[model samples]
Target: MSEPGGVSTGGAIGLVAGLLALIGGPAAFGKAGAWLADRADRRRQSRADGNREWEAKLKAWEAELDERAAASLRQCEEQCAELRAVVEKMRFAMVLILPEVERFAPSSPLLQKASSLLAEILPVAIKPAPAPPERPESISA
Candidate 1:
C-alpha cells in the first residue's frame, strides 16, 4: 500500500535504508576495525611462537652437524697417530737389522731393496713433522 502525499512503498523503503546506513555505517566500521586489530595481535603472538620453534630446530641441527664433524676429526687424528708410531718403530728396527743382514749375506738383493726404501722414506719419518705454520696474524707486521 502507498502512503499519503504520494509516497510510494518503494520510496519509503529506500528512505529507511538510507537513514539506517547514515546512522550505522560508522558503528559497523568501528566494530570491524576492532575485530581486525584483535586478529592481528593474535597472529603476531602465533608468528613469534612459530619463529621460536624454527630457531630451536636450527640450533639442534647445528649441534648435530658439529658433533659429526668432531667425531670425524677425532677419527682422523687417531689414524695419523697410529701411522706415526708405526713409522718410528719400523725405522728403529730397520737401522738395527740392516747391518746384520749386510754382514751375513753381503750379496743379498734384500739389502739393496731395504737400503733404497730406507733412503727414500727414513728422512721423512726421522724428523717430527714440521709444526703447522703460525697463524698469519701472529707474525709481527
Candidate 2:
C-alpha cells in the first residue's frame, strides 16, 4: 500500500526494522555481549592451561637434572675410594723398599737416587712412608 506522502508501507516497515537494529534493543545487544564475554573467558582458560603444562614440564626437567647429578656424585665417590686404596698399597710398597735401599746405600749410588725420587713422588698423605716397617719386616725383598 502507498501512503499519501508517496512512500510505500513496505518501505516504512523496512525503515523501522533498520532503526530497531541500530538502536540495539536489550535482547540483541545483550546476547552479543554475552558471546564476547564467553570468548574472552575461553582464551583466558586456554592460556592458563598452557602455563600449567609448561610448569609441569619444567619441574620434570629439573628432577631429571637432579637425578643425573646424584648419579655423577656417586660415581665420583667410588672413584675416589678406589684411588685411596691404590695410594695405600703404594705406601706399603714404599715402606718395604726403603729399608732395602738404605741397607745397600753404599754399594749403589743409583739406589740412593731412586730412594730420594720415591720420597719426592709419594702421595701427600703418605709423605714419610710408614716408619720403614718394623723388626722382622713384612717382605724379604
The residue-by-residue lDDT of candidate 1 on 1-141, one tens digit each, is 677888989998778666656877767557656888999999998999999999999999999999999999999999999999998998889877776667666667877777778878766332212345567875756
10 residues in a row with least lDDT, candidate 2? 124-133
lDDT of 2 by residue, 30-74 (tens): 766788899999999999999999999999999999999999999
Cα deviation of 55 in candidate 1 (Å)?
1.3
Q: What lDDT is reached at residue 13 by model 1?
A: 74
Predicted model with the maximum TM-score: 1
Question: Which portions of model 2 miss their true places by more than 4 Å?
Answer: 1-25, 106-141
Off by over 4 Å in 1: 1-25, 124-141
